[model samples]
Target: MSPTAAPTLRVERSLLRAGHGLVAGVDEVGRGALAGPVSVGVLVVGPHTPAAPRGLRDSKLLTPAAREALVPALRDWAAAWAVGHAEPAEIDALGITAALRLAGRRALAQLAEPPAAVLLDGSHDWLSDPPGQALPGLGEPVLPCAAPPVTTRVKADTTCAAVAGASVLAKTARDALMARRHEEHPHYGWAANKGYGAPEHLAAVAEHGRCSQHRLSWRLPAAALPPAPRGARAADTLQPPVGPGPGRGARGA
Candidate 1:
């Protein structure tokens, strides 16, 4: 693709022309994980025209280095941007869906100006909090915003520039945090899996058990096999059969 192409930004401009100013897109990462925090990112792009950043797509589709490189450019291109996270404890306490909503709300709340409407990258609504309800862990009350009642689409991240921008921000932020977690708990290989349950990660868990960073609510197998013991045989073992009681056996005596 040519560097000058701006298909994503073109879509962003179309939305602006359709009379939606202060349009913010919202997305979350790390929802399907046994460990690590669920992170939400909100990015508001105004009506002003500017060159779109290169290689913008669903954050999952981008490489780590590409996502990291796009983050600062997204921040600079966006009118406003913010990220918020719901840690493992919070996810366990409130559940992933609730935690996701809480994180998205917090991220949007951080914006300097409330958006006119929020475009979410999922079918389920993320902005459905009741009016006057307080955000968990934040002393501040949840302020009413003008986000759409219904989430737009499942693939809004790839289709909408604002959502793509939000995706990049959420993914990059979560990746950085997970990398730090890797330093503290080197066994889980979170730096590599980004908290996704890969085989290596499961092996690490089986060897080390769940760490504080892991969400224990996830129903991982209790008998996860760790690495084989040194010099252990690969063959199966046989057990002796139990004989009947003496008084009851032998044709009733």
Candidate 2:
């Protein structure tokens, strides 16, 4: 069940108190899905705006209809927001970690200006390069960030408004793409399964074989694969979004 007031701006407030004037929240969607590009969302919020509605929760906690309903409200509430995706080919070319970093870079590039700090949704900062081989004298992990300083908060999507907003943005954006993919491959039930390896989707894959949109690197089920029609790729159909959304976090978050 969806809870009331799931996400708060407490993290933003703390950062604001710490002299970070501009703080953006970052979240990603579709990480584990067997198909579709991974998407990242960035949301920059202002302190003066009204508090997000009490029902704003991680996107997974909300229904698809509920999540779609919140996109307009989230756009109205956020100061600035943008979404980015690393397409299926990119995911195969680069590792998921690197592809996520690429998506985040694309998101940050859309921002009007650099944020003073970033509130990443998870404790593990995927935007950063992993620690170099641990040196004997230096016992510290030198994780390198691709963007500004980040304060990684575990479950931030459920506990922080900005992060929740980011989560919603990513979730909605990815869902829309999957919905479009559903149009091309209706048998896969992407509209319902959102390109996840749901029973229906897996069954379709088993029957019709995987398509061009499927991640080639993943240990997919053995099936008679076919090429996705050379129609409009979902990424090509993306239009600039108004702002962002608020509802759930990944798993659709």
- Tens-digit lDDT track for model 2 on 1-253? 1345578887798897888878888999988887898999888876575688656778877888888888888888887888988877767766566777778777877878767889997767777555772112122253222578888988888888888888888999999999999899899999998887677887797678778888766655423233445895866444332111222122222
The clash numbers for all candidates, in the given order, read 0, 8
Q: What's the lDDT for candidate 1?
A: 0.72
TM-score of each: 0.78, 0.79
- Model 1: which ten-residue window has the lowest total lDDT? 244-253
Cα lDDT tens digits for candidate 1, 72-122: 888998999999888887777666666777787778767888777777877
Most TM-score-accurate candidate: 2
